[model samples]
Target: MTTITTNPFPVNHPLTFHRVAQPSPPTPFNSANSKHNTHPLTAYTYSTKHAEPKLSATSHEDQPLLFLLRQRKTEEAWLTYSQSTRLPGSTCLSRLVCQLSYQNTKEGFTRAQTIIQRLRDERQLHRLDANSLGLLAVSAVKAGHTLYATSIIKSMLRSGYLPHVKAWSAVVSRLAASGDDGPTEALRLFNSVIRRVRRVADPAIAADARPDTAAYNAVLNACANLGNTGKFLQLFDEMPEFDVKPDVLTYNIMIKLCARADRKDLLVFVLDRILDEGIDPCMTTFHSLLAAYVGFGDLETAEKMVQAMREGRRDLCRILKDSNWENSENADEVFVKLLPRSKISSDHDPPLLPKEYAPDSRIYTTLMKGYMKEGRVSDVVQMLEAMRHQRDSTSHPDHVTYTTVVSTLVKAGSMDRARQVLAEMARVGVPANRITYNILLKGYCQQLQLEKAKELVREMADDASIEPDVVSYNILIDGCILIDDSAGALAYFNEMRTRGIAPSKVSYTTLMKAFALTGQPKLAHKVFDEMLKDPRVKVDLVAWNMLVEGYSRLGLVEEAKKIIQNMKENDFYPDVATYGSLANGIALARKPGEALLLWNEVKERCGQKKVEDSSSSAPPLKPDEGLLDTLADICVRAAFFKKALEIVACMEENGIPPNKTKFTKIYVEMHSRMFTSKHASKARQDRRMERKRAAEAFKFWLGLPNSYYGSEWRLEPDDGDDYSTDSF
Candidate 1:
């Protein structure tokens, strides 16, 4: 153990410098007799042999005085505590308190103890005020010393020196708002204070120590921050027990928590209590109420709340006028009487209350959202007009309002109207965001307007300075598939990857679907293989089902079967779609026996069978339309008329009445092939001839002979030339 000190004095110098390290042994810094020992062991020390040469002349006599300038640490307080008896260390104590107030806890508390000892020596310990102690406690908390802070507060309270409510509130607020263990610590401190307050015999001292509304509100806000509704309600109910009254903020907090939890009943109960107490609801109260009603989609109730808010504001204004309080400065007392605990400032004049309850843009936006949900387009337009006529700039329609309007119109398939809304958004200086443009993209895609969708993508990049995202590329790919433009879909897919936007599962699925529809099963499988090789994409059951359906569509039943087996091996279950695809493929392959076996399996799994009794009523297994139609056609083709009758019976039993026109056409085709149609009705024969003519016209449009099957349309070379970049 090497002894070291900044003061280069030998250990024999007793009063000259006291920080000499004893060669005996090291002990905990706390165990050192700080009072008698004089020099407390500090963290940083140096051996004499290793001490810097410049520090040789540094005198040990001024060590205590030199520590006063030490910027960091509690050394100055300790030095002042040990020496300098004539001079009061009030400034040093204040500086130490400031440094310790919510900073390094271990060091702060230690320094605070030294300051307390010095104050004790001066006989001024009891003279410390509530504000000074409260600040000390708060500072301790900032240093993550909650227990120490709690002890300070508890000591003050027990001594009958009730800390200022603001101090208690600040400490509670900080403790309760901390990440994990804060609320627990705050609760413990609160319980201790409450216990102490109740035990106080003197009413004046008890009142002084008792927490006020603000302190309670701070703790309540902590509960609200966590969204713990149960804890919030329990704490709220305890307020009256403590003789504390719930103010406007209390009710506001309760309302917000109830809205977030979607507890409409609790909200109503709280609102009723507020009304019974004659509490004037503030703007936040109405805002929360409106949000709850709108979320519930009870537009009528939401509208009523808006009306009530207007009436309430008007009533408040009438009371102000009837009281003859012209200016807010003179009206502060009057307003407080009318609205208890109301915060009114004397510095600035407030805006006059509106003569009528004119709803602001936020309210209108909320109402418009409700209308849009109910598909009330006309009502949304009317609200937009109302928003534009607002008397205050704060009530002006904002970007969110316009974005919502554009989205609603797009969903309603009013592309032209949606475009007009977009134009109006730009005119109002509300730039269209990616979502706004994406909505328009969807609208055009629904109409198979690919050219317009492409134009929007280009405009988003070039004009709006917004790069197209994965969703934009996904939409473009989907739009191409909708119009059977496989080449366009491929080009968009490649462009997305080239632009460093990885293709999503939806992108891959769309490409596969396009290939399947174009009589290209091989290309669809190739796409599936590529998707599996990419680690970034998580392959889902839908992707597997797409692959199975592609093979099934090509009349490759064995290949589809293999795909299903592979799905099970990979821990992916085959759903209704998998079985349906396999059955369709087998039936189309002219393997009636295999199709029958698969249908039986489907019936068993669905817990359904042929209805033995015509009148026996219970709903049948609800198969999707695609599966039902395919099975029905297969039965009709196999000439299993009884099975076809069974299909019809189940269809009717399940409330899914078969399409008579479709069944009739299948029946007629089977009949015409088996025999001459001499007995057919004239209308039926004429319809059959009309279908033949339509098929011929379709063949002509494809530029194929009557029996030709292979037809592929390639894109013009110049189509993608302009959009090529480094991504190519």
Candidate 2:
């Protein structure tokens, strides 16, 4: 047996504590100390600092009362006892632990944290024993206060008190699992603990300080959360050096990381190593691998992996039976009783076999999600059927199962089939959720069937009792806009507001777009103004772009420019669409010079201009194909042939293909100018003579002797016709 070292602080330390000095507030200084002061200056200095309160010795009579309160496990009464008897800090700390222990409610947890902070502020934190602090740490983890938990552990460790393994694991795991700033903080704490453990000279102290597998796994989790694949792999390799062998969770974390990094080779290598080392792969292990294969489009391998999982489930049942768990109907029924709710839906529902199985609904749901990703409707259908038919598996279809199926079908453009799946869900006692209904609504709207979408919304309210949320109305408005039903969109928008459902940013943007396309530019502006006035709605670039596009479409060049300037004033740079819209508007209005200026500004903004261009100092914007095409068309219309050709070259340099029709139009126009030029007359006459000779030759070949060979084929004397200016 491993003998634990003696604790520096006993679990039942005396409540007596010496009061520490608390810093006082700053005092107001007087001018009397200044050497430059005039002759007779009397000044008084008021010091806010007060003397430290003396410590009170422990009362022997109060100890019995504190013990009685602790014995009865009455935390509230302990609080009253501490106040009445002036018990030691140890009693206060014990009361705090008790408060945190029974804190199952959210409000109770909040009160516990408040008490912990209050004790720290009062300089009573030193009275906490290692065990009491450990309990506090665990409570912090349970309450999701990872930072508080880490702070508690760090304070105890700094005081040379080593926390138990469970405490360390709880704090580390909470920090690692937190997806926010927790991962970064978790790494910092892990490093601190590791360094402290390494610095300790005593072997016994070091043993208590050294992190175990759980602590290491927490760090691994942090690395995984941050997607630091390189760091994760490095630490994974170093686990053996730390005398912490990889457990099932270690492999599971590695597999998940590998899946995210798309390191298929590494994932396979780890799984194979697990098998070689006789480490049984848990459900998470297989789930991670299966998700990876499905994500990478290796559906065949994923299907086989699912089959292997099923076999593993059967093997688990056999092992359990051989272990005498299945000796009688009621022998050791823990396994069957502890089956996940996902496996067996209701309490009254019986397990499929004499015992529970491992390949429950989650595995099937995971596979269904993979199929959804691959868009394999047929395979998803087959899997659903397999779940329904599996005799020994109580984990047949659930709500998640039906929802995944419905969403997949909707994405595949199968609305009718999706509705049928929803009906099937209802038949299987799995009611359709908001997500399921929303998917169907989106499907209908995507097909431009707004009437069907409206009917679906009505059905949701009338039959399903699910209110049409902001998202539902947003989709409906967008659907109306798709088929140019502006009035319909507005009606829905008004109805949404009347129904007390606030329009989201998407709602406003979609409505703006609808108004813009219908030539209601002013209405679009009104919509934007309303969004700005509403405190809940913060207008984004998409909203501004839609309004700008509306004005530009109506040849409101100045209005569009003002919108861009306003956007700049708001610290938002104009994107390619904004710049392109303005440029096209200016060009169409026949302001070539202004259009060229706008294009140069656009090039500078998009980082397309040479460094020599004066306006290249602004932050870069992303240039899209539409912007380039607009500039090229503007140049073509302006008859800046040389500049037009330069624009084409710029387009080629930027890998933006020139618009063929627009380029050909410019090319023909350039040649027309050349045809009318004095130097090209001789070349043009030669081309005309070549065509005439070829026509005569073709006539001779056809044996039409009465053609150009006769006197009727006289060349009309250079009489200027419509082609005179164009001809040589």
- Taking the tens digit of each residue's C-alpha lDDT, what string does model 1 give over 1-728? 11111121112321111112221212121233333332111111123444422213324543443355245444554565456654333333444454454344666555665565555455555433344466677666665545556656665654445554555666787777765556766766676766666665554444444677877887777766666666666676778876889887787777666566654434444444465567765656656666766777778767765665555454432232232222333333322332332333323232333344456677778878888988998888887877788677766888778877887888788888988988888888888899889888988998988889988988998988999888988888888889998888889899988888777788898888888878788888899999997644657888889988988987898898899889978877677788778878877787766666666655654553465553423233456666766776676566544455555555666677676667656544442232123565677567555444443333333243443454432223232222211110
Q: How close is candidate 1 to the true structure, as a TM-score?
A: 0.47
Candidate 2 global TM-score: 0.54
Give all candidates' CA lDDT scores. 0.62, 0.64
| Per-residue error (Å), model 1, residue 677 | 19
The number of the candidate with the highest TM-score is: 2
Go through the candidates in order and give the clash count of each: 4, 0
Per-candidate RMSD, Å: 21.2, 17.4
Which segments of model 1 are wrong by more than 4 Å? 1-298, 305-363, 391-395, 412-414, 579-583, 608-621, 660-728
**What TM-score fits each model?**
0.47, 0.54
Against the true structure, candidate 1 has what lDDT? 0.62
